[model samples]
Target: MTPSIMSLFMNSAFLAMEAQQVVWLRMMRVAAGGASADRELSRMATEKMQAAIQLGTAATLAAVGGNSSERIAANAIRGYRSRVRANRRRLTK
Candidate 1:
């Protein structure tokens, strides 16, 4: 594979790991009584739904516009990565 392809894979892998960390941290906060469990769970679920919608919309637009496969994948990944990064920042606080 080309270096750019490898880099994309690596970046996606790293993002996945960070997202998992965010999930665990959020859960820990609720378990430790730092946040109300019901509210936190509801918020998390809502965020996931929003992210899914954003990702689907981006990917669909790219695909319909006749962009390359890579572009479509990038659009989806970009939206997801942005959300994951934001969650990571917020949860780390």
Candidate 2:
């Protein structure tokens, strides 16, 4: 990949982490008498869960495939999933 693309991917990964943090914070707010946050948190969590399932499935397909389409789709999903794996590697300051 080009350096520019790599940098963009890095930025996107950080953005995704921020989005996840926001979702968690919203959940906390909902717990602390912020009922309005519930709908948003629920929506965000549902979307994230669906995405995670798709990524996990694609990763699994990449792990075990007999034909070509599965492998191709897996590779494409893996590219997207790399950002997710990056988000998991949080830094402590």
Candidate 3:
């Protein structure tokens, strides 16, 4: 594989790990009774909606611009990565 592809794969792998960490952190918080069921469900729903919007927008732009599939995937991944990073920071504190 090319260096760029390798880099993308590596970054994606790291992102996946971060995403898992965020999930585990949230689970821990809930298990510890730190968050109410209603609030947690609402927050999760809102986050999923935002992610869907972002992915849709990215895909639309890529299609209109005749960009490659990899670019679309990269853009989608970027949106998730940012959300995951923010969640990690918030959960840690």
Candidate 4:
């Protein structure tokens, strides 16, 4: 499959996993109870949410097949190699 399509699939999977984790955390917080417990749970949930967002962004980038610089560099290298090969062939003839 194309890189773009593959990226979309990976991003979707990552998001699904994140959703499950959020649900699990919410359930745990509800089970804990009490004002103090609620405060702690809120803190923990906020931290987890931040981390999940960071990770999700990374996953999205990976799914998107990363930055264009790498692809551009590779294409440049391929073109240069092809040119060199053609020059060598001409010199030989």
TM-score winner between 1 and 4, please give it.
Answer: 1
After superposing candidate 4, which stretches have Cα over 4 Å from the reference? 1-3, 36-93
Residue-by-residue lDDT tens digits, candidate 3, 32-56: 7744645766787899898898789
Local accuracy by lDDT, each model? 0.78, 0.56, 0.80, 0.51
Count of clashes, each model: 0, 0, 0, 1
* Model 3 misplacement above 4 A: 1-3, 34-37
Q: Using TM-score as the measure, name the better of candidate 1 and candidate 2.
A: 1
Better of 1 and 3 by lDDT: 3
Q: Candidate 1 has which clashing residue pairs, if any? A: none
State the TM-score for model 1.
0.84
Considering TM-score, where higher is better, how would the candidates rank from best to worst?
1, 3, 2, 4
Reference-based TM-score of each model = 0.84, 0.38, 0.83, 0.34
Q: Write the per-residue lDDT of candidate 1 for residues 1-93, one digit (tens) a residue.
A: 223666668778978898889889888878977447677788899999988887887788878888877666665666788888887888788
Best of the two (2, 3) by TM-score: 3
Q: Once model 3 is optimally superposed onto the true structure by TM-score, how far is the C-alpha of residue 60 displaced, in angstroms? A: 1.8
CA error at residue 84 for candidate 3, angstroms? 0.4
Please list the residue runs of candidate 2 whose C-alpha ends up more than 4 Å from where it truly belongs after superposition: 1-36, 66-93
Q: Global lDDT for candidate 4? A: 0.51
Task: Tell me the tens digit of each residue's lDDT in model 2 across 1-93.
Answer: 223455556665666676576546655666766655666567657757877787777767755765354444435445555644543343111
Residues 26-79, model 4: lDDT tens digits: 556557777745774676567557655765565556557764644433333344
